[model samples]
Each structure stands twice: as C-alpha cells, then as structure tokens.
Target: MKGLSWLSRLAGGLVRLEGRKFTSLKRCQDDHFLTPSKGESALYIHIPFCRQPCLYCSFHRYQFHEDIARRYFRNLRTEIDLYLDRGFRFAHIYLGGGTPTVMMDELASLLSHLKSRLGGAVISLETNPSDITSKNIALLKELGVGRLSVGVQSFNDRLLKAMGRTSHTGVEAQEKVRLAQGNFETLNIDILYNLPDQPPEVFRNDIAMVRELEVDQVTFYPLMPPLNRGDPLPPSLKPDNRCEGLFYKMILEEMYDGGYQPSTAWCFSRGRMMIDEYIVDYGDYIAVGCGAVGFFGGGLYANTFSLDRYSHMLEKGGLPVALFRGLSRSEASRYRLLTTLFGMGIRGDGFPRRFGDSPSNGIQSLVGLLQFLGVVECDGEELRVTAGGMMVVSRMMREFFSALNRLREYCLRYGI
Candidate 1:
C-alpha cells in the first residue's frame, strides 16, 4: 500500500511538471514581441444579454431578461467604482456584447458612471442591426458616443437566415447605417463572409452595398465555427479547406475593388481609420462586464464569464475577474506582435524600439514568405499586406500561430 501511494505521488508530480512546462511555453510564445514602453488605457464593457444567440456565435451572451439585466448593471456600477478607486484612467471606452442595445437603461447608467470617472473619452459601442432604433440612436448621440459598430453580417436574406441571425434584414441594416451616420463620427459595419450557402456573387453584391451605404468603416470577418463542440453546423457550411479558401479569395477581391483597406486580419475601413490609429498609437482602453478582457498598466485581465458569479463578485466589492495575468516583459512583446499583425496589418521597421530586441529570424522569414506570395509588399522599410494577402489574413495569422506553437513545443521538449 505504501509503494502504491508512492507511485501515485510520482504520477502527480509528473502531471504537475507537464502543466508547468505547458504554461511556460504558452507564456514565452505570447511574450515574443516587444512591450509598449507606455501602455494605453481602454475600457471595455461586455453586455452579456442578447435577444437570441446566433447559431455561429460562442461569445458569452444570455437571452434578454430585465431582472437579470438590472442586477447585472447594478453590479457593473459597483465594479466601475472599484476601478476608479484604484486610480485607473481610461482614454477609450468600448461597450460590446450579445447585444448592448438590449440593456439601454443599464448602458445609460454605465455611461453616466464612466463620464463621471473618466470625464471625456472616446466611447464606442457595438450592436446588432435589429437593436438600433431612432431612440437608441438619440440616446447614443446624447451620451457623446463617438463610434458605433453595427453587426450587419450580410445583406442577402437567404444568407442571413442560413447563418441563424435574428437581427435586421439587409434593407433594415442599410437604414440603420443611414440613421447611425447622422450622429456618430465613426460608423462601422461588421460583415461576415464564407457563410453557410453563401455564393461568391453574394460577396460582390455585399461590397457594393457597403460602398453605397458610405459608412465610415467596414470590418470583414470570415465565418468561424461555433466553439461549442456539440452545436451542429449548418448543412451548407463545413470545415472543408477548399470551400473556405475559394470564398475567402472572392471576398478579398470584392473588398479591394470597393477600395476598402485592410486594417486588421478580419477588419477593413474607409473614412477615418480608428483601429489603425489605436494599434499604431497603442491607445488605452478599459473593458468591463462579463467575459470582457482589458489591458492596462502592463497587465491583462478578464471578467467572470458567469453572470451570477460576476454579479456576486461586484456585490462583494470585487472585480468579476475569473482570470488575471500580469504580463512579463516578454509576454507583452508577443501580445504586441499579435495585436499589431491582427489589428493594423503593418510590419514596422522599428521593432527593436518597440520590443527590446531585433525581430526573430523566424518572423522575418515569415514576412519574406508573405512578400513572395504577393500578399505583402515592402514600402520602403514598412511591410504592408497586399490585396491578395488580405483575403487570407486568417491563414496568415494561423501561420504566425504555427511558428509560436513550434517554439513552445521546442521549449517544452528541451526544458527551455
């Protein structure tokens, strides 16, 4: 029995060692880029309530219930007060969620609290097309909201139904965009491509629609499978490689023809470039609400994903933080790289200045390869993704991830 107990202890030790190794590897890969010398402060508020969950969405969202929302908002106010006491100053505020508009009163209260704490800040809110009414638009304008990111997904009714979106139709979406333009300085539309049963021609038509709408910016994201393994995928959409590649290419061509520039791997813009400016300048932000992640003061943290838990935490005078990680210098660097690549699509020559050391050979080689593929072109010293490359930005990001993974595996195997 003693021998058996000793064996069990040995097994436990091995398991712990493996876990530590894995964590270390992940940390190293995450921190491979340079940390910003001066970090920006941004606020993000997550509204977990949604009218209904879209089939492909896995974000932490709940169905609209006034009682639940009211409780959540009360807790959120408490959380904000706690942060303000901690001396956190934020410049950018983002309200995102299942549907932020669903909790209009709560949103107003939260914004009021934020204004009291931070004074003047660049406030942005993301909402579904269905939620944007004239009243909501008026409220947003009155709140001094500078940006509105509307989730339009697609203009085609068939495609929208296939994607299981309960929001506005294509026509309704256009009207909302028109309404939003009158108030917000930056109006952004979020569109998705490679949807189930979406044809190549649909993308071309969508681009035309975007051009006609003449909004400030457009974000084009490819369809990502729902994170829940048990959720059944649509019959028209499979994880097939060829179908995805073709659709991606078609979307890229259409976007380029419409004169939309790539701001991130999955985002594009037209008039005023908000994302590019943020990434390049390292704009500060604050993130609030359930499952919303925030970076400030050289640390990254996320709120609790559970609504009940989050509310309880707030009531107890604690931030609804389920996970918190203070980034080491190396970890901050890697995050910057990932953010820069995904956000701005610009490879700056001033890597050593931003990060601490020169760019790794692996990253340089990847850039070179991308350049060779005609996906990126060298403008003087700056590396910019070309139109062709923008189509497969997700694939490119995967390639970066692959390299990071390899590095991690090597570190684990050799105990580095």
Candidate 2:
C-alpha cells in the first residue's frame, strides 16, 4: 500500500510536467488540419451556457442569455460547415455542456442541421437533472439522441448543497432519472466521489441509490478541482486525493456486487452501452464550438474560448481554432496509451495501426515499467490493467484533467 501511494504521487508529478508541455501551444495554421483523417472520428460540440453553473466545475461556460445563445448556435453551425467543407466526416456526435438542453428550440435547430448534413449520426448529449422534463425528453428522442447523461453529482441533498448544486434535490434527481430511464438506448447518470465533507456512508448510499434506480450506466467521477487561483470550488468542497483510493475500492465492490461491469475506469454499465465521454470511443475527434478542444493527426488544438472572438472568426468565414500543438511521436504514443488504458485496456495490434509502429517499438519501456510494478499485465500481445492499477490510472487521469482545468482557467483569464 505504501508503495502504491508513492507511485501515485510519482505519477502525478510526471503527468503535471507533461501537462506543461501540453499547455504550451502555438498559433494554428489553416492548412495544418486540412487533410482528412484516416480512421473513424467523432464530433464534439460544446454549448457553453448554463443557467446555474456548479461550483465544482471548471468548464468554459457563461450565464444564460437567450439572445446571445441563439446567436451562438448560428455561429456554431457555421463552424460545423467549415469542417464539413474540409472533407471531414463524423458518424458519432457528442453534445456537452454547459447544459446543452438549456434552450430546447436552439437545440432542435442544431440537431436538425446535423442530421441533414451528417446523415443520422448517433448523438449523445449531457443535461442537468432539472432539464429532464417530459417535453425535453420527448424532443431529445425525436432528435434521435441515443444516449443521455444526466449530471446528478450525488443523491444526498447535503452533499448536493455542499457542492453548490442547487439545480435539483436528491428526490428530484431520482425522479428525473426515473422519467428518462427507458427512453434512450443508454441512460447514464454522472456521480462525483471523494468530495470534501462527503462521508463514506454518503458515497455508499449514493451508489446504492444508483443501483435502485437501475439506470443503464453510472459514471463515478473523482472530483478534480482547478489547480490555480479563482477556482470554482471552495476550499471546503475541494477533493481529498488521500481518500480517492478508498472511494474507488468501494465503487468496484458495490458496482460488481450489483451486477454492473466497467466500461471505463470511471463508467460502469449493465450491458453494452454508449458512454458519455467521447474520448474513450474515438481516438480522433473534431471539436466545433467555442472552448471545444480536438485531438487530430498527431496534434492537439483548441477553439477560441472567448465567445466574442469565436463569433467574430466564424462571421468572417474562418475556423475558430486559436491554438495548436504538434506532439512528438513519443508524446502521441503516450497519450494513446493513457486514454486506451482508461477505457480498461488496449490490444497490442491497435498500436501499430494508430502509431505506425508496434507497442514494443514505441512504448515498450513504459509498458515494461508498469508490468514490473504489477499495475498491468501482458499476455502475449494483449495488455490489461490489474485490479491494483485501476486506482493508479484513476489518479493519473485526475492529474491530467486538473492540467486541462489549468489550461481552461488560463484561456478564460486572458480571453484566449
């Protein structure tokens, strides 16, 4: 246990160092991403408006304004057309917050445009618990949304209040879940764990409530607060990394005991289901909205986080991409390994097809180190995470997300 603790700290430090390299981005050129990708890619559309933003969130989001939101949706469509003109194709689409369902009319218009242009692509969307009304659910189903993820956070009213989530109470969230249970192909409920002032019994009861609800899937996210000043979460609501392993262990026992299986490190399901996090399914995704980030063709890029700049760029007939960073072969390889492992494991053969080299040739030493630590095991050409490695990977991913929040804070602060 001591050794695992040491490794977690070591991994966190290394990931933070790598994150610095990631955040140091350069000006993007139009020609850099013109060429079409080689494999299946998803489209991620960000809707950065929320009626009531959560205190624990660091996503790029603005307060709700109907006129501004309507204009933003128009600009968003223009950005999508830019990608379509570039010969990019997306069969899977994910719509993420700040509360994508805040405006039903705008959402319907956007969905109609996407279906017409993209041809019945499978759509996954996220919403707050308060937005799961009958009218909203009917519209989502009509729009052909196959997966709906509700950001429930927790079912304890005390925890909800502590997290500064006034959107819905414990019973209200459960009722919303009940309302949307069988309407979609997969209904995923998002829960946060290891929050400050959250007790073990609170988390335990939350998991038990999730099982009682019997939703299609449950995603338990470890709370990852921002790494800089002006954090959204108060000090009282900050996550305690020391308790993360304990929470994760409880998750493993309860979910498995409840007849649930892992679709990823953080997501558990009863059967085959679409997950909310698009990163787990598509290695390369095109992000096409203000504050959206994309990984493509060995480079990472982010659209302008400033809504004014984003609209201006689009209105002038240009993409809203503000920064791009071309990663080294080693860096790209490590990224693939990290995401794939987070989805549970990766086949060895996939490395060659994606990286143009075998796993041993590109990341053998890293894999070997993980193997030596008994965190992962290799059987012939297949590598998988061990039971002990789940928490390690969880911690590693938390650090990575914290790095992203740092980038988000930086961009929002400077209007980049």
Candidate 3:
C-alpha cells in the first residue's frame, strides 16, 4: 500500500502535466482535418441544460429553460449534419448531458433526425431517475437506444442531499431502476464513492443494493471536485481523496464476489453488456453539441461552451470548435496505452496495428516499471493490468478527469 501510494502520486503528477496541454487554444488549419477516420469511431453529443446542476459536477451545464433547450436541440441537429457533411460516420452514439431527457420532444426530434440520417446506429443515453418513466423508456427504445445509463450517484438519501442532487430520493432511485430494467439491451446504474463524511459501511450498502437490484452494469466513479481556483465546493461537501482507495477496494472485492466482472477500471458488469466509456470501444470519436470534446486524426478539439456562440457558429455554416490541440506522436501513443490499460488490458499487437509502432518501442520504460511493481504483466506481446493495479489505474483516471474538470471550469468561468 505504501508503494502504491507513492506510485499514485507519481502518476497523478504526470497526468496533471499532460492534461494542462488541453487548456491552450489553437485554431484548426482546416475543419476538414477534424473528420474522423472511417474504421472505428463513435459520436458523442452533449446536452448542456440541467434542472439543477450538481455542485460536484464540472461538466458544461446550464439551468434548464424550455425555449433555450428547444433551440439548442435544433442547433444540435445542424451540428450533426456538419460532421456528416465532413464525411464522418459512426455506428456507436452516446448522448450525455445536463438532463438529456429533460425535454422529450426535442430529444425525440433529434433522435428521429439521427435515425433518418444515420440509420441503425446503436444509441446509448444517460438519464436521471426522474426521467426513467415507462413513456420515456418506450420512446428511447423506439429511437434505437440499446443502452440506458442512469446517474443514480448514490442510494443513500443523506449522501444524495450532500451531493446536492434532489431529483429523486434513494427509494425513488431504486424504484426507477426497476422500472427501467429489462427495457434495453444494457441497463447501467452509476454509483459514486468517497464523498465527504460518507462512511465505508454506506458504500458497502450501496454495493449491496446493486447486487440486490441485479442491473446489467454499474459504473463506480470517484468524487472529483472542481479545481476552479474559486472553490466551488464548500468544505463540508468536499471529496476526501485519502479514503478513495478504500472505497475502490471495497468495490473490487464486492463486485467480483457478487459475480460481476470488471469491464473497465471503473465499470463492472454481470455479463456481456455495453459499457459507457466510449473511448475504450472506439479508437476515435467526433463530439457534437455545445461544449463537446473529440479526438480525431491525432488532434483533440473542443466546441465552444457558450450556447449562443455555438448556435451562431452553426448559423453561419461553420463548426463550433473553440479550441484545438494536436498531440505529438509520443503523447498520442502514451494516451492509447493509458486508455487501453484502463479498459483492463491491451491485447496482441494493438499498438503496432493502430500506431504503426510497437508498444515496446513507445513508453517502454513506463511499462517496464509498472511490470516491476506488479501493476501490469506481459504475456506473449499482450499486457494485462493486475488486480493490485486497479487502484493505480483508478488513480490515474481520477487525475486525468480532475484535470479535465479544471478545463471545464475555465471554460465555464470565462464562457470560452
């Protein structure tokens, strides 16, 4: 554990440094360059309107207003057409947001348009408990949504209140889960851990409830507070990182013992199911909608955070991309390694095939050190993360996302 702590600090520092590169601005020489390669890519669409934004969340979101949301959804379709016109094609689509299901008519319209344009793409959407009604479920299924992920952050009412989530209570969340279950190919429930004053027993009970409910999958996310220098979270609601590993260990032990399997470093499933983290499935993805981010052809770009700016850009017949950064060869290779490992393991020659360079020739020493530390193992050109290494990867991912939250905070603060 001592050694693991040291390693976590080292990995955290490295990821923070790397994440800083994403905050800078650079204009794309040609918007056409942002089009994803044909082979394997996904589309991420963000809806930034929420009824009430959570204090701990750093994603781009705004207070819900019907007229504003309707206009945003219309502009969202236009943005999608922009990508489609750029020759981007995707079979996997993930819709996430402030409350994707908050405006049903707009959502249905957007999905219908997607179906008419990009037929039969498997859609995965995130919703809150309040939106998991039978009507919504039928509408989602009709729209070709195969996976439904609910953001039931915790089933503890006190914890829920502490997190500033008031859409539903613990009992309401459970009932909603039951209501939505068996309606889709995969039913995922999100559970959060390591919140201020949240006890180990509370997390264990939350895991116990997951086993009782028998959902298709559950994603356990560490509480990552916003890093905006303004300190958005009160001290009473802050996340206690020191106890994060303890909660993670409980997750590993409980989930595995309950017949669940690790689909990714943070996601566990009962059997073959659709996982939420699209980066693990698609090598590249195109992000649409305001405040969206995407990676394509070795470059990372973000859409403008201001809804007005986004709409104006689309109105003028241009992409709403506000920031662009092309990663170097080494940085890109290391990124692939990080995400591949986060998905559990890297299998036979994936690196060489994807990057045209062997994994050994890139980030070899980092791999060597992880191997020596028993965090990863090499077997016939494949590398796998050890059980002991889960926490390390968890720490790495937490740091990566925390840095992203920082970027999001900056964008929101300045309306970039």
Candidate 4:
C-alpha cells in the first residue's frame, strides 16, 4: 500500500512538472477547445483592488493603489485587443474583483472600450453594498452593465465585521438591494453561512433576509477555511463541522420554503433568472488580470499572480499567463464531471458519448459508493447529488483533491 501511494504521488508530480513546462513555453495554447459554433463568449475581468482583504478570501487581491491600477487597466486593454484580433465575440462580461465598484471610473472606461470592440454584451459587475451608491449605479447602467453581484457575505453585523468587511450594515445592504432590484436586469447577492461564531438560527435569518430582499438570485456558500499556504488556521474564523452541516440544512429548508430553486449547490434562484447560464451551457470565457483564470478551447490558463509581473508581461505584448494546462480528453471529462456534479447538481447522458467513456471507472466506483451512502442517486441516465451530497460538496471536492494528492505522491516517487 505504501509503495503504491508513493508511485501515485510520483506520477502526479511528473504530470505537474510537464504541465509547468508546457505553460512556460506557452505550448498549452494548442489544447484550447474553442466553441466556434456558439459564436458567443463570456468575459471575466478581475479588478484586484479592494478596500480591505477579507479574512477568509483566498483570491489574489491587493489594497487600492491608483497609479498601479491605471497601469493595470492599460495592460487589460492590450489583453482585450489580443482576443479581439483573434475574432472572438463575447456575449456576457463579468467584472469580478476585490471590489469592482471601488474603481468606478476605471471600470467604466474598461467597459466602454469593450463595448466599442464587441458592439454589445451583457455586462455584470460584482460589488459591495457600500460601493453601490446612486451615482455609481447610474454610471454602471449607462455603461451597459445589466447585472450586479453584491458581496453581502452575511447579514449579521458581527460576522460582517469578523470577515473584515465594512461596506454596509444589514439594513444598508437591504436598501442597496432595493435600489438595484429594479435598475439591474439581474441582481445576485452572495451570502455566507457557517462562520466560526454563527449558529443555525443566524443562517436561517440570513435566508429570510434574502427572501425579504426578493433579489433575482442568491448564492449561498458555506465559509471556506483559509487557504493561505503559510497559516493553515488563521485567527479570524475557523470552520466548524457541526455548525457547517446545520447551516447548510437550514439554508436548504429556508430557500426551498422561500420558493427558490437550487440552480446549483451554492446558487439559488427565485424567478426564472439565469445569472451565470453561459458557464453551465456550452459557452466560452476569457479571464484577464492577475490570478484570473480563462478557459478557451480545451485549455485552462491563469495569469501571473504577481501584479507587477502580470503588468510587465502584458506591457511586453505577452499574455501574462503564468501557468496553463492542456486538458486531455480524460482530464476534460473529469473536469466536466466535477463542475456539473457540484455546480448544477445534474449530469448529462450525452457526456459519455461526447467525451469517450463516462468519468473513469475509479470515479464511477466512487459515485456508486456515494449513492449507496445515500449522498447521491443515479437513475442510470442522470446522476443527482442529494441534499446530503450538496451539504458536503466541499468534502466531496476535497476527496477528488485527496485522490489527486495520492496520484501526485506516486508520480513523485516513480517517474511517469
């Protein structure tokens, strides 16, 4: 058993090394599976500036810097030009950030350039409630932004403070939501449950708050433990297993009672609104900015995490891609399985016919075990994760990570 584990790790390491080499030479570009037939694509532009970093955020973000930001935006325009020259047409654009609303003027400029290039696209900008003033909202609407994704991490003031967020109070957040409800075609609010000090009732009330807001969509995500490589356990908040389980249970019960459909594990919709429908459908996206990841063709590429490095690369007429991987057929199939099973809670029968066989035999066996354990159900055509499975999607994803870790260990010990 020990030998086998080592062998798996060795193989995984070799695969990772090969991926690194491929990324270094930008050779992974050939593996992209562009959806030419779709003719439409999604665009994700990462605005890394934030008022302050959240305690639990693992994404690459930095505090506000005007000079640096201006430089970054220039590079961003260059990056967009690269894609425009490639004859890509985008239909949806998402500006995600540390807080996109922080740099309203810059964001508007970026959107203006994109609109001039793409003609028209459904633009969504993620923001915090405090940043969504009347003036900024009007500016966004004028700039052709139709959707707003508010980061209302939690309605609880205590939790909000703990999360290092100071944008708005619960009441203020509600007011912002009200303002955005009619203005934006789609309004998606993000809420987090299972903080270190939160209880089940608190989470229930949070859902009730969402119900009261009557926003188009609500994304309920459990608190993820800090992922900083150095400090495994950050002092701000810790993950509680029991509280997490109860939190999810409460969310499911309340959301269902509120007449929201489980669009995905973390996503719930009240009406027929589809905020991120393109990703679930066969659409393409271009991710630009530091630490932003883009999916094109069958390839996944990420820009440099360092702000300076990313800017320098882009200024030098490079893609700023620090790491990229060409997904093999099997790897792409596994990626789809992971995304679908966890995201939409639905698996397609056409997947197997399109991507060689069903997920690997190993994955099938794991799915069968999960089914027997009552975490999932298989109707032979489509597989669905039960409420229990949804509650532990994080754990299930971790299991895949564990398997990958074992594989990595094996590969490291024995050359693949």
The global C-alpha lDDT for each of the candidates, from Candidate 1 onward, is 0.64, 0.85, 0.83, 0.68
Question: Per-residue lDDT for 1-416 in model 3, tens only?
Answer: 54687777677788878878754647553576675565647999999888877777767788998888888998899889988877778889999987798898889999999999889898999998998888889999999999999999889999888878898999999999999999999999999888876889999999999999999999999988844546556774677887877888899999999999888889999978446788877777889888888877787788888989999998988889888888877887777777877888777876456556455446777778889988899886688888888788888888877877777777777878
TM-score of 4: 0.80
Which portions of model 1 show Cα errors greater than 4 Å?
1-40, 229-231, 236-241, 276-286, 295-300, 325-331, 345-350, 357-381, 396-416
Q: Cα-based RMSD of the predictions, in order?
A: 10.7, 1.9, 1.9, 7.0
Model 1, span 1-416: residue lDDT tens = 22223332343344344323323322212321212234446667778788877876645567889999999888888877776676666677778877887878878878887888788989888898887888999898888788889999899888888878766788998888887785778888988776658777887789889888877788766654443435567775443434556665655666667777667766667755667234334633456787665555455544556677778767877666554456665556655654555664555575545554455424556456656756567675566656545544455443343333333334323423
Model 2: residues >4 Å from true position, as ranges? 1-3, 29-31, 226-233, 347-351, 355-361
Residue lDDT tens for model 4, 1-416: 22223332443354445434333323233323433345777878888888866767645567888898888888888987877776777888888877877777788888899988888788888898888788988999899988789988878888788777776787888888898888988789998776777766777788888998888899876665543434455555776644545566677788888889777767888778464644544424678887676666776666666778778777777677654566665555555655565564455684444344544534567567667756568876577877656655544343443333333333223322
Cα deviation in Å at residue 60, candidate 1?
Answer: 1.2
Task: At residue 191, give the lDDT of candidate 1.
Answer: 81
Model 2, position 311: C-alpha lDDT score: 96
The TM-score measured for candidate 1 stands at 0.78
Please give, for residues 1-416, the per-residue lDDT of candidate 2 as tens digits: 44687787787788888877877777675636645776557999999999998777767788899999999999999988988887888889999979999999999999999898888888999999999999999999999999999999999999899888998999999999999999999999999998988999999999999999988899998988743446544775777788888898899999999989877888999977445677877878888889888888788888898888999999999899998888887898888778877877766666446545555445878888998997788886677887778777777877777878888877877879
lDDT of model 3 at position 134? 89
Candidate 2: give the clashing pairs: none
| lDDT over C-alpha atoms for residue 295 of model 2 | 85
